[model samples]
Target: MGDVVRAPWDAYFVTGFDTCSEVLRGRNWLAPDFAWQERQDDPERWGAVATQEMTKTLSRLNAPEHTCQRRSLGNLFDRSTIQRLTPVIEEHSARLLDDLAEKLRWGEADFVSTVSEQLPISTIGSWLGVPAADHPHILEITHNQVYAQELLPTKSELATSAEATGHLRAYFTEMVRQRRAKPGNDILTGWIHHWDAREPDRETADEILYRLTMFVTIASLETTATLLSAMVGLLLGEPGRWAWLRENPGHIDAAVDEVLRYDPPIQINTRVAAEDTVLAGVPIAKDSMVHVLYGAANHDPRRTENPDAFDIERRGTHLTFGGGVHYCLGAALARLEARTLLIQLLERFPTLRVTTPPVYASRLVFRRVTSMGVSI
Candidate 1:
């Protein structure tokens, strides 16, 4: 593919590192918000409930609305908050790893289910004050809802996403009511307070808080878990790597960074030309959709030396968390969780080995590792 390749479906795909970065940071590029979707030729595709629901998320909004919605949660992942959550993350990692160790005592344990899936949700769930008991249910709905975020979702997947979105709306709406009635010291309560101060209408404030909460959960859960599983699986797959990490614990940060570059969770990000522009010497019209391939960009030989090989010592950056305004807000938290968990996991199960290859779900945007069998 050239810097920009036109798809058969009439969309543009940006595959080069420089071109992808250019589009992401370009002021003329906009995410596919409600306005953009409305202008599309396919009304049925654009008008789907799942599509409409996505426009309200922080990931899809443009300019002022994106800025305003983002500002409301400015302090959510600040340095102080991450510092405060370190111990909580460690505690959850330790407990989850302990459970994994127990399961390994009998036979092979699925790391994805036993540890990766549990740690991220537990850590984020605790921070948001969502009950531990509801983690499984929330995880299910998020999985279903993510289908709509794929590069090419079928009508069936869209329907599933719509149903999931409805359940999420109802679940979070009630949670918002409960929090308003009996507020706590959690992030959700803090968001409610933030919105209440700005929005005059109580209903409007709650609605804002609902979207914020839902975004936080969906953003933090699956991707981080996939990252955790990928990091562990990659390290264990290479003989002596896990032991080397245990001996050289100082390299945990670098290891995590390399994993992010090698096997990023989100592969592609969608945006529309806000105005007529030329990218890589190619003219693009306004309202044309562009899909920036993050995974491809991360592996571009021009930007990275031996791009396909996984080397923990490499300090190259990755577009896994994206770039520019839509850069992942929970990036620090995700890194913290990964580093904390990896450190403990190496210390506890240095002998852990992958007995079977990891199983990834079929999707173009989000890389979901459904199962990875491991043995001690």
Candidate 2:
């Protein structure tokens, strides 16, 4: 068990792996009640407009409502659906790697821009049926929107994020319109059909659809990019790890899992007490904020042997995608993207080298690499 540490603003932090798991899986704990209201008041608080919009998303909903939306959306991300997209992921990875190789010929390249950032956003944009030409705009909007979640935003930052959010909403609205008129074989089209079948009033259904689309788009892009960047930094940090990966390409899945465990993308998850209750012997009040320190739990020695060591062969799971009803909808997609990129990279450049140390981003909720220089 872990101690309950007090956080700023009278909130509590849950650090034990088992306890955190309990909190995540428990139905009594719920999404923070004031999350949306807080974001609405100060648009720059967490994710600005994006966070404000997500206040209405499935992740923020309770039981029956969450259950319905999750079930309907679940089919879109099932194993078979994700498996069919492998070739698309591979094609994107190969193209990005080809670009990286060309940049390396000029001595060095910024891997974060050339590969880490580009691959995930591009792949996700394609998956969402965003035209290739519109990907850059969407990526810019999502990057600004997602980065705002890292810290309390400045007035200027908040203004910029709010503007980006408007652009995103406009874009999504147009896409939704297009999907409704002429359905396609894309995830968004599937979601639209699902929402339509629900038969809710037009305004209510549209609101739900737009919010859900924004939530999925931002979540998929930001976390996937963060994971890829972190994996690259970790692999290249040690002397033999890169070469080891090249020799043991079969270990890519385990390596990806290990990376998720050692350095998860989203570091903290928050919940609020739905009713007055005791947790791990601690007293609780309704609506009290409880922070689940996923990063800390992942590193907890009691649950993981040699927790600090980055052993790819470690045989266990981490809370990187969270757990229970709120588990990440894109978990499989993320793993597939990472595995595809790593395999393709190792096969293409057997002697990958880090040209410079990686610079990490400073954020409260997410661990990300801002830039890294590398060469083949």
Candidate 3:
């Protein structure tokens, strides 16, 4: 439900909300110690997380603060900005498909690492002014970070994530320093100036580096990669729908929206209530965690007709990218990449077909398929 669709309707309406924390994030939303403030007096774990986000502009937000940051970002991320990126998206998609055609000319290829993963990597990297050469590195780090804290994660996976985080932090710090010394017209450079111009010393250069890199790392890599993989797999499963999209090129946007609704990359989002709240008659205590189930909400029969069906012409926006104060910041860019990639695929491989079941990512907060075998 976008805004309480029906009885037993969602309260927060997306993956980023806090109430259903355990259901979505394996976190205790009602834990007495739950705090978004990141107070210094909190336990060691909370403090550690707080410190980690000191430089993360995207993560360092709560309620009104989050709203304001989102607004500021939105000012630069509207339809106009997305429209500007269309040509670039198309160009990148063309190059990627060219590479894919060469590799799979014999009629078989793993489409995940080769296709789904590449779109977001190059798009996100180019937007942030990073060399295309670094796309693979960013993708690897992002995958490790997201998977490390996943349910039933192995000890080595946890350790690898920690190590990746440490190294990633160090890498971004240098990247930021270099960018600041020589400003550019890229997203990261523009944001660094946006913050510095407001308060010259409020946020240190190191903090700027940490936040932008982390956001770009995940926003451009993990979520987009998942959505791309899922869409490809879903299309391959129903060859009829795939063929329809190929014919009705204008329906690509609707197709992207439907894929998000059916198999959202980030399945759940968490948010904390600052005061006592009642959602669908469930009294939520102050500071209560609420997990907004986008997957559940999207499939709720009350809100949608034939909820599970993949309709390329589905109407209305769902809460897959989130809503209100914390809607996704990278949505515009993600949409552009998807359209470009799909367009190129349809134009080149006249007989695109799936040969194997896709391999899913070992994560619940975000679901991604790392492999999909396709035939031309």
How does each model score on lDDT?
0.90, 0.80, 0.66
Off by over 4 Å in 1: none
The Cα RMSD of model 1 versus the native structure comes to: 0.9
Tens-place lDDT digits, model 2, residues 1-376? 3556767765789998988999999988997534424533343364456556656677677777788878877655677877788999999999998898888888889988889888888888888887788877887887676544543556676677678888988988877877888988777877777777795687667777787887888888878888998888788778898898888887899999999999988998888887899887898887777889988999998899889999887866799999988988889889999999989877888778788888876677866677888877
> What local lDDT does model 2 show for residue 246?
87
Q: Give the clashing residue pairs of candidate 2, or none.
A: none
Q: In model 3, which regions exceed 4 Å deviation?
A: 1-34, 37-57, 63-74, 148-157, 202-205
In the range 1-376, model 3's lDDT, one tens digit per residue, is 3322222322334322232322333322321222453432434434333234432456435545445555445465578878878887888888878778887887788888777888877776777776887777877877776644342345566666666777677777778888888988877777676667755674564575466567656766888888888877777787577777778888888888888888888875555555776655556655544556778777766667888787768774466776544457778778878777877877787688888788886676778787888877
lDDT of 2: 0.80
Off by over 4 Å in 2: 33-50, 147-157
TM-score rank order: 1, 2, 3
- Give all TM-scores, in the order shown: 0.98, 0.92, 0.83
Model 1 TM-score on a 0 to 1 scale: 0.98
TM-score of 3: 0.83
Clash numbers, per candidate = 0, 0, 18
Candidates, ranked, lDDT: 1, 2, 3
Superior candidate under lDDT, 2 versus 3: 2
Q: In lDDT terms, how accurate is model 1?
A: 0.90
